[model samples]
Target: MTAEDPTHPDLLQRWNATLLAARAGREGPDPAPYGHNLLARWAEPQRAYHTVDHLRAVLDRVDELVDQGGEGGELELVRLAAWFHDAVYRPDRSENEERSAALAEKALTEAGLTGHEVREVARLVRLTVTHDPAPGDLNGETLCDADLAILATDPDTYRGYAEAVRTEYAFVPDEAFREGRAAVLRQLLSLPRLFRTPYGAAAWEERARENLERELRELTGAS
Candidate 1:
């Protein structure tokens, strides 16, 4: 379902609550309006892969890591990052991540988060573009892994995710899209590791590689 469907008021409420909880009792502007504004952005029609469902999935992955003791006590900042990671999504724009990071910084600062915490949130959001973090950057690793969790989903779900991404880029011709998508898959395959965290690597690496290669072959008509 699209973000504008209005069937998930609870998710929107949770988004608002998450933001407020990020800076609990600190003095700042009310974050509910900002939360709703972000929800509207996610609901925009140009998005397919990057939507409210994507955000929820990232948050769920964070919870999964937390359950597995992998989050390293940075859950709050990670949640804020997830909320803003795609807040500025533009299917045709290359600077979406940078803009999203800026948005995170502004919103968090307005919400009374300390400058350090705001920087952390923005850093995590920006890392979504590369999905790479220093070896000891647990918060970055956690957010990046969660953002990419869809790559490891079951086949049918993976196919759906692929289609949604294509839909987001529907303006591109099929030939161009195929070339672009194949390039992306090849880059992903070239990575030393798709997932940075041990938990993510163990849980998703093989499946994500299979999914990526399969899609790459299909896109390039390779055997």
Candidate 2:
């Protein structure tokens, strides 16, 4: 979605609120410009799956996890991390997560967040690289779970997600894409659990595994 999209205003409002709450009455520049910058990044033309819609979905899932008692981390930081998680995405690059984390560190620092706050946000952004938070890392678990919640979507929605991901990597040959995508599905299926948060584990884990396995079968031509 672009700046002219209908949801832009509401997203900006959400960004402002989250940033201010994170600051906790500390002084800083107005949040609107920063929101616009991040929004533009999310709306970049090359993005298919990691667009503004994904940003909103992740943020909403973060709220759901917190409200459902699935997460006990610092909500504001998690929200910020969600915003920055795919901010620097490029389909062909493997270093997008690290670049996104660096962007969070620089932008949040310039926006007047404390050093610790900025670092935590960057760390959360980088955690998307694995989506496997270490034990007891509440904030990491929250962000990673929210980011991967798409895997648990209904079959039709999950198909759309898979298609969008394919669109992002359109340069890849069909066979290569299939092989790579199958490998990713296998890796996820091999994980002991797909969702770390209690609510996610209860509500999303089974469906996510089912979706991954089904996709893997399709990709690999398995019986």
Q: What overall lDDT goes with each candidate model?
A: 0.87, 0.92
Q: What is the lDDT of residue 48 in candidate 2?
A: 94
> lDDT tens digits, residues 53-72, model 1?
88889989988987876948
Q: Where is model 2 poorest over a 10-residue stretch in terms of lDDT?
A: 1-10
Task: Score candidate 1 by TM-score against the native.
Answer: 0.93
Q: Which residue pairs of candidate 2 clash?
A: none
- In Å, residue 55's CA in model 1 sits off its true spot by 1.0
TM-score of each: 0.93, 0.97
Name the regions of candidate 2 deviating beyond 4 angstroms.
1-7
Indicate the residue-level lDDT of 98 in model 1: 98
- Per-residue CA lDDT of candidate 2, range 127-219, in tens? 888888998999998998999999999999999999999999999999999999998887788878888888999999999999998888888
